[model samples]
Target: MLEKIKRRIEKHQAQPIGEQRTFAVFLPLVKVDEEWHVLYEVRSNHISQPGETSFPGGAVEEGESFEEAAVRETMEELNVSKESIEVYGEIDFIFNQSHHIRCFVGELKHINPDQLQPNEEVASVFTIPLRYLKENEPEYHTVTLKTEYNHDFPFELISNGKKYKFGKRKHKVPFYRLPNQFLWGFTADFTHRFIEIISEDTNFLEGKNEK
Candidate 1:
């Protein structure tokens, strides 16, 4: 049995445990007027979260790498070819029991936000100057998480049964109030993380707008 387990481990590719839906997003940075700007998409009515702000990204398909999915989603959403995009590198990624999101930072050459034609998934495209984002701070909110169990769950198997003590884990949601847009949730977390890296100050964003 030990030998069999050793053989299995040799061929195993380590990945996140449990079932996870993988995703990737490209933080497309463009140079406008000698300054850098970050582009975002407003979800159109065709998608579920219409009018919500987001970056170019989608689910990672089977047999596709993280970068490949990011680039493919960018091309399909922005209506641009892969040749127009130059992927610099990856910053960091997010992993949870249900989701794994990877972010890639790169530049978009020879094009502006107004020039690109987006797909049905995109309602419109807009740009936020990196300098402006670097200057402004975002808000953070911590909310409680609901606890539920399967109806068939065996309550008698554990001590205290229905009154058993369970650890409290709250969700940390972020909000970025741009001049005209309101960014929040996981997307906001990604944006805040990117800013932290580029600004070289992990604690740069304080709770100025916390609630």
Candidate 2:
């Protein structure tokens, strides 16, 4: 088994990176009242993207495996022990121009609102029924990407550089509506993939109550 793993690793090619960061996030599926729901964390106002909703994760630390970083971030944000989390598998990789994200799906051993101990990094925690996501689709919007160069960039260095016009890139972002909350960007994208994965197992999802 070790030899096979080593062979696979040796043959794998790392993705190219040009100052792009890597992050890992775990989607925690908690069973509550015979229904499966996904837990989401709201970033504290003091942190980046304050008040924005996201999964329990952050940038991968140096020399840390993606799975390790995912689990560590979950534990830190949720204040739960490692034993409470059972990582199943990873879904598709998410990437933008500036960063890459790994989304891991996992089950929470216990689900109790009172037991949660969110730290300063997290403003609040909430759960949405998985059935709702499976039944609904996110609204998509196209946003244009603009590029800006530094003031010191020398236009004289390259021929016709001053006259060069950069083309605009369009990105489609999806947003999901819940009572009063909105799930968009990376979180919504990850949820969409999760719904796709679970939809394949009719028996598993049918066991839970939808609503």
lDDT per residue, candidate 1, 104-129, as tens digits?
A: 98988878788889999999999888
- Supply candidate 1's per-residue lDDT for 66: 96
Candidate 1 — which residues are off by over 4 angstroms?
201-211
> Residue 73: error of model 1 in Å?
0.4
Q: Could you give candidate 2's per-residue lDDT for residues 99-169 as a string of tens digits?
A: 88999999888768556888899988889887788788899999998878999888888778878777899
TM-score of 1: 0.88
lDDT of 2: 0.87
- Candidate 2 TM-score, true structure as reference: 0.86
Q: What would the TM-scores of all predictions be?
A: 0.88, 0.86
Instruction: Give the number of colliding residue pairs in candidate 1.
Output: 0
* Residue pairs with backbone atoms closer than 3 Å in model 1 (clashes): none
lDDT of 1 at 97: 92
